[model samples]
Target: MLCIEVLVEEPSAEAALKSLLPKLLGSRARHKIINFGSKSKLLKVLGQRLAAYAARINKGENLRIIVLVDRDQDDCQDLKNKLEVIAVQAGLTTKSNPDAQGQFMVVNRIVIEELESWFIGDIQALRRSFSSLPSISPTSSPFRNPDNGGSWEALHRFLKKHGIYKSSYPKIEAARKIASQMNINENRSPSFQCFKAGIEALLSQENENLN
Candidate 1:
């Protein structure tokens, strides 16, 4: 199992992933994987970094492993399809499985941004605290007061609801708590029993796709 990582914004994200993913790698034998991405206003997002990342990964000497992606939309599947197209354009075979005779695990990205999904909660109510504050329009432009939906605000409600507000800050840090809950890497999280099964199903489907 080759391991590689890239970024989104905060360097702490990379630091956090380093701490998080290695433990998630489990018993797989680690192999060399290229790591690169830049953090800048116009360049931080994966949309801007795809070409550079694609170029780097195209030079693989062995079967490949994918670095993860963001949770902007339910588009991880779309990203995989795009990557397969890109790989085809580059004249390379894209292995679509994590465990196969030779296939490398090449697509591991998390897209669930809100923690409530795993917490068995609702969306409308989840963002109500921040969303109800005000309504800013496209007509407002830079003056359009954007609603704050930071983990800070989200966690406050979560802890308050769960009756954990009295404990400490840890009880209400939404992103931290979400990160703690989500594996991000596929190999972690004992709670994701179905997730593991889905990975197996994906591998099976990919094999059928190959055939």
Candidate 2:
């Protein structure tokens, strides 16, 4: 059986993935979510965590590790390179640098700007979660590209304009609700699509191993 270990930077992400991963992994694979409380804390401890996973893999564990972080204000390429370097330092192959057979034990994905970009990417999912929200056109200004900066703030403002989360956005609650309605196949966020693609690749590799 294939087991996936997902490392996320915050509770909201954990909440969102909790609702989404079961739908993605199905009965063919099992997954565990590890929330690191904050992005700073996660980065501080990431090296140690990856080292531990490398040790487990050396013991012949059928485990795959996924590290997810928000791009926030960081340069995307630099952030990705940092993650790849960490995995290599831990003696594990990353998706960015696969082995000769094209197999990798780790995948690093960034939520472009922030997790709320995913909510902004899928207007239908947002409407499903918050029924009172007016239909938003994907061609509209900010909604057109959900990967833009200030994603959570943009989402909060949009929701507040609709009288939902009028005071403040509840990160975890909104994440769970919006993610539950998200169509993995239909999200418009490029980052979200990349994330979904990474999971699909992991599953594909697992199937190849089984064969």
Candidate 3:
């Protein structure tokens, strides 16, 4: 079986994935999440982490790494290129630059704006998580493209408007709740879809290896 090691920048992303990965991987794969406390910290030590993983892979361990970080005002392509460079420096093949056989040991995904964008993408999931919240049209402004700027603020405002999270948003709590109810297939966020695609690609590779 393939063991997936997912590295995320913060606790909320870890909380969200805890509920969502099971729905995606099922019995086909084993996975673990490693939270780096903050995006700055994660980026600071990412090279060393990937280098360690590369050493393990060289020792014949069957492992794949997935790095997830929020875009948060950064140039998206530039951030991606930075991650790709780190992986290459660590001697690991990334999804962006696969080997001759089209196999890679790492995938780097950026959550556009923030993780809450995914919650906004699936309005039904948000409603299911917080029943008191009113319905939001998928085509509504700002929310129509959940990947737009100020996504977390947008979500928090809507939640507060409905008397939920009246003070500050408890990110981990909201992520756990909303993500548990999220239908991966129904999410409209392009970045979320990209994340799903990365997982699917890894699973597909595992299946091909078994064959």
lDDT of 3 by residue, 172-198 (tens): 999999999999999999999999999
Q: Itemize residue pairs with steric clashes in candidate 2.
A: none
Better of 2 and 3 by lDDT: 3
Worst 10 residues of 3 by lDDT: 133-142
The TM-score obtained by model 1 is 0.41
What shift in Å separates residue 12 of candidate 2 from its native position after superposition? 0.3
TM-score of 2: 0.98
Query: Each prediction's TM-score against the native?
Result: 0.41, 0.98, 0.98
RMSD of 2: 0.8
Write one digit per residue (lDDT tens) for candidate 1, span 52-89: 54566567522333433333344556755665554444
**What C-alpha lDDT does candidate 1 achieve relative to the native structure?**
0.38
TM-score head-to-head 1 vs 2, winner:
2
